[model samples]
Target: MRTIVAQDVVSASKFNRFHLLVFLWCFYAIGFDGFDIAMYGVGLPWMMEEWNLSALQAGAVGSYSLFGMMVGALVLAPVADKFGRKNVIIICMFLFSAFTLAAGLSPNITMFTIMRFIAAIGMGGLMPNCISLMTEYSPKKQRALLVGAIYIGYALGGILASLIGMYLVPQTDWRVLYYIGAIPLLTIPFFIKQFPESLSYYLARQQVGKVVEILNKVKPDGNFSEKDDYQLHTALKDGKGFPVKKLFTNKRAFTTIAFWIAIFCTMMMAYGLNTWLPKIMQSSGFSLTSSLSFNIMLCVGQIAGTLIGGYLAGKIGYRKVLVSLYLMGVVTFIALSITTNVALVYFLIFLGGASTVGAMNLGNPYITEFYPREIRATGMGYAQAIGRIGSILAPTLIAMLLVTGIDPKMAFATFAVPSILAVLGYLLVQEKYGSFDKVVEENGMNEEFIEGENKRIIQS
Candidate 1:
């Protein structure tokens, strides 16, 4: 595992065939991840129409999926730590893909909802592990950039969903779309064989020989500066026992709770807005095209925002940047709710997308920073799993409000409170321990902690 961790510093130019292949595999995983995420969003309208579901029922469907995702995030993340990231990835992909494909074959609303719920579990579980895996193998200098790039696959998938809706939905049924989305699963088998085990995981377990073997496969030419001097250590800092328990007991407990709150709030706002934007717009006297295009505008903004946020995160501290970004989301969401002008709405959408989307990206990296390597995945999973609660509840809450005849603008505007609150949460995070890279610094406390444990920390 130390050897795998040692290989973490390879220059981009040194990334040979195996690197390229792994990047593509991760990319493909992300693409499919995107597809599955958007599937319910795209199908919601049609499903509502066919089943004569009220706004509340439609919202419930979304909530169900989010609830399932929360379960997966909470449950699978720690399992990844206890088991292995690669195995978790494979199992999750299978679970999600199979359920998603089955969603296409559902004979009734109940059955369809069940399938979506199951698939959401797979969707939630895969994200952190993928982020962790990619980061584990990527070069250190390019860690943020690579993570950002991997996230682009998610945006690309959203765009693909929009494109499919634009071109295919009018001509074909939504079920066909589900079938097309499921097609990406074919890559899972390929990845299982080809995807490398996280070296950091091996090293943490003191399996030095296995780490060396895996490193050799990635660098056949033997160019990595394999040195015993380059000791690998876990970034975890809590007590030596089960890391999950330490999350609440250690110095990081306060910060961890803060992050989870921020995640919950932001996700509630994000999912709520994404789910209800069209309805809100229609209430504001917009046509279907204009309302639908609102989402496209948001996606464009998300892509642009992620890029800008990634750059800023590199320049400033991750904590500072994330706080500012969440604040931006708070302000923009309120602006979006009040603005009547289409152009201003689009502008706010872009800016909000930029800031809030980046906040979403911060979860994995932030988790990587907060916990030691020994329990990194566990920490991330717990955060994400808990965070999924906000996402799961958003839709149902919004639906209930809509049923109550709450003003559309006012309904969505309520979400802005959370974004602002998230800024507060981020500020509470200790700047000294707010980034994963801090653990990599010379003579850092995390290093000492890892040495005592004699384990390698895997980060992605």
Candidate 2:
């Protein structure tokens, strides 16, 4: 009997109900992740008024969630690789849902901040795991597009939160937003019932039985049996040990570091804008409802960007698409700094969201292709963890700058720096590693390309 590699089965299978279920479930989970993360900003105006918070104090409160996300990404995401992606996702979902509800009930800034931080831990862990699971299940040709599709949930979540703030916040209170945020808890039971474990994860563990079980569902026609042997088409070693060390080894050091830089820069801009865009617009004389509507427009642009970026990535390739997006981000931010017309400002905000948030979403599929199954979640986790450091600084830095009397226009222009740096970081990444179809055809998986490319880099 011939050896059956799990990925080949997945790659060759037609899109089926199993794939749709997995995609929809991940989409639902990440939507809530976006909602929880963006809620702080949506409610910040109200919180500031209700609590008499200084700009710095409000920014600090937002930073707590980013800090928690950093810790969660660094500490908890790697555990998914060790245990299972499905399990980590479930735990993360429960944590964020329950704590977001708790956050709404807080009587003081300290307690509210603490609850937000705790909720963020779950949000952080949930995102990368969803990306990893989606990546593993998707066919090579559709991987980036599928991952991007799942990420549309994030933008949708942001839009939903902004809409709630616009219609409900004025009628009720800021706490009502948090109450709506808790609705994700209901999906946990559905996830427990429906979510499938990553076939690659099981294959990495040499769990032949489980791999067979999943492959059957993934491609019911495969009719996989325990009598068949299995293999993964990657060059990385598999063993019973921590995979974090592997990120720095196998000539991955530079690629990993460069990837982290791109992640950090992109995330800084993303969190910074998401956390402050509404407030910044309000300061510019927009009504509170109108400012929140700007957030909705921003998220709507993110949805457009993710879909368009995914399509372009599939056509032009990931590196070119990402580089172009970051470059466009530079232009959009600069334009946003100077634009005065309300219609133009909204259009600029939409473009800025597309470039920043859309580019950030693109990073997941791009990075997913770089690492092997053994460390995919870990590599993504560490990259996101480092990025969270930027996320942590973004809102606070913007707040401090405004509080110190810097013009909001100049503050917006400052965003151009990270956009420029992100371009550089993307440039530094080995393009051969990112060419999904070519690598998949030539080496069966991109990790083999990374391993071989690293060898040449070391030798030269």
Candidate 3:
């Protein structure tokens, strides 16, 4: 009888054609998500002009999308567990693309806000689900780099948003940007045909026929048949039960809380800057075109930061790299407030983008390391959902500060507040708690459980 070790498959991870496909689809999916979310920020100035919106109303429009993202991350992301990741991706794609297309037709801010909020609900699940699925497909040693690599999609998506805004908004209407969001709706059918299901999900269901098929693609050993038995590491098994309880199980309570707090703080910075930086730059005396152009630098910085941070994490560690990014944020934000040199201002915004969105992107893979496949999306979703509260608050709060005639320097400095808070929260994360080996060792989950044929899946 043939026996396959699931842990061994992941441990001796190798990249092949399968991994490349996963990477491309995930990158495209997330890039689409990025485009959808950032379009609001990119088009915000024109929308404000068209609607004659006050600072408060403009800020409220940004928050509407975030509010929907909160719901998707909090409520919809966990559905990936039951329905499967590929299915959820398709549903999310349709919701966002169709509604974003509908949004372009809205005649007023109220309707635009409603359509954006629903589209964002689709946007919310994309990150957690994509991050979770990618983590599953990546090799253990290369996990950080590959996971971090896919996140460049968010920056790429944002970059596309800015480019489209620059060319289209000035020539036509801001609503035209929303029309572009519907482009993804065409790819939903393609995803179903090409995207693979989670290997762990197949194993959990004891669908040995399907598991053998997918596993062979990832790690092809031609001698497999339905008669063979396979077992997963006890620690890796997606145990059945309430997933949230598992977040705190086996000495993880403190670390889970720390992740939520840090996510909350970091997201406030990431979404706040993405939504408002262009407007703030325009307010600081740059022309509208120039302000929009700066957003491309911001996204470029995110791509650069993730690659740099991923490399640094390999040298130092994920936790340390995250802290360094936050410290960088503290200084860059302050510098941005006082700088008048256009070149220097662009550089500062570059740093701001890296420290803000880059940190959030880096944090996802780190957070997923703690959970089994069954609940990876759930943990990520909840963390982002809690983080979404801060996001939901950011635009309005920044708008409130702007309307009060606060010094531009002080308004910029406020972003630094959450950066510091994120640093402190991550400082408190006990890395040992995230270690699967530690959990296995502490609970005394035995070799027999890891070796027996589908033992954990059956017992659970």
What is the C-alpha lDDT profile of model 3 across 298-352, one tens digit per residue? 9999998899998787567789999999999999998888777889988988898
RMSD to truth, every model: 4.6, 4.4, 4.5
Instruction: Report the lDDT tens digits of candidate 1 across residue range 295-398.
Output: 67766776776666667776775677788887777788788768878788889877766666556775456566566555667777777787778888888887
Q: Over 4 Å off in model 1, which ranges?
A: 1-20, 204-209, 216-240, 433-435, 438-460
- Give the clashing pairs for model 2: none
The lDDT values for all models are 0.69, 0.83, 0.81
How far is 310's C-alpha from truth in model 3 (Å)?
1.2
Better of 2 and 3 by TM-score: 2
Candidate that would win on TM-score: 2
Candidate 2 residue-wise lDDT, 1-460, digit = tens? 6566566566555688888988999999999999988888999988999999999999888888899998888887789988888999988988899999999999989999999899999988988888888887886667778899887899999998898889988899999989988887887887888788877567666678888888888878667888876744342247356779988775678888889999999998999999999889888888989999999999988988899999998888788988998999999899889889999988988888888889989988788767776678888899999999999999899999998776676678888899999999988987454323222333322222223333211000
The order of the candidates by lDDT, greatest first, is 2, 3, 1
Report the error of model 2 at residue 30, Å: 0.4
Top-lDDT structure, candidate number: 2
Q: Please report, as a residue range, the 10-residue window in candidate 3 with the lowest summed lDDT.
A: 437-446
Comparing 1 and 3 on lDDT, the stronger one: 3
